[model samples]
Target chain A: MKTSDFRFDPSQVRTGYSHSTIFKEDGFGMNYCSSCGVRVLTQVPEGDHLPRQVCPSCHTIHYSNPKILVGAIPVWERKILLCRRAIAPREGYWTMPSGFMENGETLQMGAARETFEESLARVTIEDLMSVINIAAHNQVHILFRAQMDSPEHGVTLESSEVRFFEEAEIPWADLAFRTVTQALTHFVEDRQRGQRTLHLVDLETTRP
Target chain B: MKTSDFRFDPSQVRTGYSHSTIFKEDGFGMNYCSSCGVRVLTQVPEGDHLPRQVCPSCHTIHYSNPKILVGAIPVWERKILLCRRAIAPREGYWTMPSGFMENGETLQMGAARETFEESLARVTIEDLMSVINIAAHNQVHILFRAQMDSPEHGVTLESSEVRFFEEAEIPWADLAFRTVTQALTHFVEDRQRGQRTLHLVDLETTRP
Candidate 1:
């Protein structure tokens, strides 16, 4: 479909629009909304050149824009909290304790909640790690650089496993999402810029 | 309906499965996809909270999340690019020269395109400004602190009119999006931070 057909009123930015078909043939598959678990509808309407997805309830439209996905950059000593997913798309892949933004929750709260839920490692979020947008998923994932309250806490959520991987040990290939890779990249870049100032908190008093 | 019926995937970070009744009863109106203008569907088979939007044609399901919008902090000499919208939601209110990212465009490209499209002034995007998640529209709007290519170039887009208003001349009450106000706040804050190194570039030529 023509790109212009998909464009809508700027005011519609608040509420998304319905989509027409845009994918080429053989694109049929379970279109998963990473943030919203809706099944993508791919039917192209008449007078449309492309297939698009639209929110059934909210009537908001979807675009391949970057979404703000928040995560924890919790560090204990020289290690950080990482979770192995117990779910699909990339089951068993490692990721920072992170998730998407929720209604009524600030970015800070989202990061904190995800960190605690995934790692059981309570942390007081520090400054931002970096804002990286994964446009393919329409997410602007925010990795908040936090410090853990304790270093010895075990896993809590549906994580297959949890571990404290040192900077050199980060598994770049097995990262759950590109955001983690981006976050780690930023972490290293920032460190090179001399920004890795650990407050040197003891692991004993760090657990919730 | 259960809150799960209006489920949002924290994993993906976008809204899906909102109650269809919410829109029908509240008259919030519907948003359509920009690629193919169609009303996004709402009903699902049953008990599914996957947060998906559907297309009528091509029958391809496409998943979408929140979008990240970037803006330019147009500064000319001691003035900036500000406008009064001639449209709705905030009719006649003031806002920055900003728009959404088109497909296949970079964040910086979108910013530059939007700034000139809305204000008619070309600029060289510079440093990053503070990023904010505009939850009201399910967008993460990033406002970059930018520099005008020519101080004398005027605005050319949907603005009621354009002007390089000085800080003291800013019409605070008439300001539009919270991001605009916030950007202005940061501008003042940066000045107070005592970092007054405004990069100067000679305007080789001018544009109408």
Candidate 2:
């Protein structure tokens, strides 16, 4: 496939490496600075092959191999909380309270913060649930099981509406994304089975 | 917090309206382009507010939303099929065989394709196991459970290395990412619990 066949251009990101090679064979070690949007290249040994790129402006090393964090699933009586984007793609469609990991936070902390930010609900994270590797996009998605601290949390304007729906009442047609539908299906089925396995991991030094 | 506090700017990828301010209650209908990543300043009618972005280059209407597909916890008696990257980022790290959905391809097809590509395994995706909403960064991560088609689908250098490890033999120190440990934990617990619930959902989409 031609370089253009790929959706994104690494060169557009300008990480010092070939901003032109389409299918990159090395691990992505550099990245565009979030602050300045400048590409950062990583320091590698003369012969050592690393994928991360370092930013010359801010001096931050970008891992071409970025990782995704697993968050939690908070369920209310037969229903779960979801959000609708105040923005696009599926603006006004339904979604769960989710966001990316913030600096200096654990995966669970990121999940809890997002859940509260979007849903206005404070939840106590229960257990480590699942971790998903979406290699197509080069991300790692993580999941956790959490308990609702309050059932009275109101909805944010970020969501069109926030109400618990029975498994059968899920507005499948109106769901925000495909992942939301799939996740709800799994949650409902697991609840019916009444089997929840609580698992935790030592998060001393999660990926930096 | 100042808008600058946010690291990754959606402005680079989104168009039309200011993502930083669109979330304000008073800032309804402000739009962004799904393609050109331009922030358009427009007022959208309330309630009927439809905020969507269209990509300029690839006529692909950008949906900053999550999608789902299946993944496998493919295992032999004591070993599992893990993938090491031959590409960038965490190039030398290990991962599971997981991928996104394709047109007309069932979830199983996506899972199998990922497995074969990453680990070079020929296995039948057994049943719907778990759904993880790895939407933190953008895409969702889904996981499933499967039985290996053959035990001899030996290691291929397509990845750094493909190997099996007993529960006791898991190389905790050298794993690729956080999700690996999370997935492995869930797999082990499920095996011990007789695989009570075969499915899971990563509700809080954005974590890492």
Candidate 3:
């Protein structure tokens, strides 16, 4: 496949969002200190380079790091299981089972959990397929190759529809996010080459 | 090397800290909502599995996800560069140049930036050396193999001392964290075997 096949149109993505805007959407805007309920000041702390939301009363420097998006491409009998997202941020667009990695879980565990949560499919996570850095979105997308325990899966709260698709049946234009498209492409290419190489990509999102 | 060789003693590590304590230390404690400056409630929101610090006034559910600690094992002339941390959490103990990943940077970028910040060395990130999941600590440590730009490096504010060490000269017993020890071991083992492989590990920290 050509590299241009994955070049996302800027108009197709969510507009009017920058890195800081995405950070705020992830519940990271610190107008007030969570520790002392005091108003926070945006300033670089001593020995720190970046400006952080620091509290004057309790002296707490609040930090907001990039979030990890763990996911899995669940395979059963050479077919890939996908879900039509029922949530916003591309509601109706098709995507692999994925979500934010929660605390108290490994990457593999998070991938499996998200798969189950979204598609109602239990998967045995096999290998790391792709690690796509969406720096503009303040997120890293980690996708794993997984084997479905059973071919049984149904619709859930997170997914409007769930079904298995052959390689040719994937909807490239209807994929939820750029990271999803990139991961699925990597998975197909690696499988065709009979390789299990980890795909690392720093995705450059087009800004408006 | 045997698997038992990497088993860490709980007594040798930090004491009296659980996953919740570690979460609070990571600046995730939400006694009050940062958005509305009102007291927050710990409850599972609608259709959510885990209990989050939710704002009743703003209806915002505050999530605390696992954090990523990015680092690099800087390689120069077959020697590995390491730093002696001057800050708390294993002060003065030897560690790879690592810190919490910040916003607007890729994993490789964060690794290179942390290497420069702690050891005053510039590195071209090579490959994915190790990804260790410390679930109890709510952290995923991602270490990369990096090639030093030059042979010049000195002590920085984060590192009290910085130097390159041959394989035999590594201070394994004095390593700061279990994740560091595991990553370094993987690095050495892979180098000796003439292999470039991604090391994925779920470190089971011994609880007191």
| Highest lDDT model number | 3
lDDT (Cα, tens digit) per residue for candidate 3, span B130-203: 88888777889999888887888999988999999999999999999888899998999989999878888888
Instruction: Provide the lDDT at A142 for model 1.
Output: 65
Worst 10 residues of 3 chain A by lDDT: A1-10
For residues A89-200, could you state the per-residue lDDT of candidate 1 as single tens digits? 6888998888765433446656776776677777776665565533333334566677787785565545889898888888998998655776777776677788742111
Give the interface RMSD of candidate 3: 8.2
Q: Pick the candidate with the highest TM-score.
A: 3
True contacts kept of 1: 0.09
Q: All models, DockQ values? A: 0.10, 0.05, 0.36
- At residue B27, what lDDT does model 3 achieve? 39
TM-score to true structure, per model: 0.63, 0.43, 0.89
How displaced is residue A134 in candidate 3, in Å?
A: 0.7
Q: Any idea what lDDT model 1 has?
A: 0.56
* Superior by lDDT: candidate 1 or candidate 2: 1
Residue range with the least summed lDDT across 10 consecutive positions in model 2 chain A: A1-10
lDDT of 1 by residue, B1-208 (tens): 0001111234332242245422332112323322344545643423334333455654334344455567777888868778778767687888887776643334555577677767776777665555565433445566666778776545443677778888788899889866777777777667768652221111121111
Number of colliding residue pairs in each model: 61, 64, 0
Residue A35 miss distance in model 3 (angstroms): 0.6
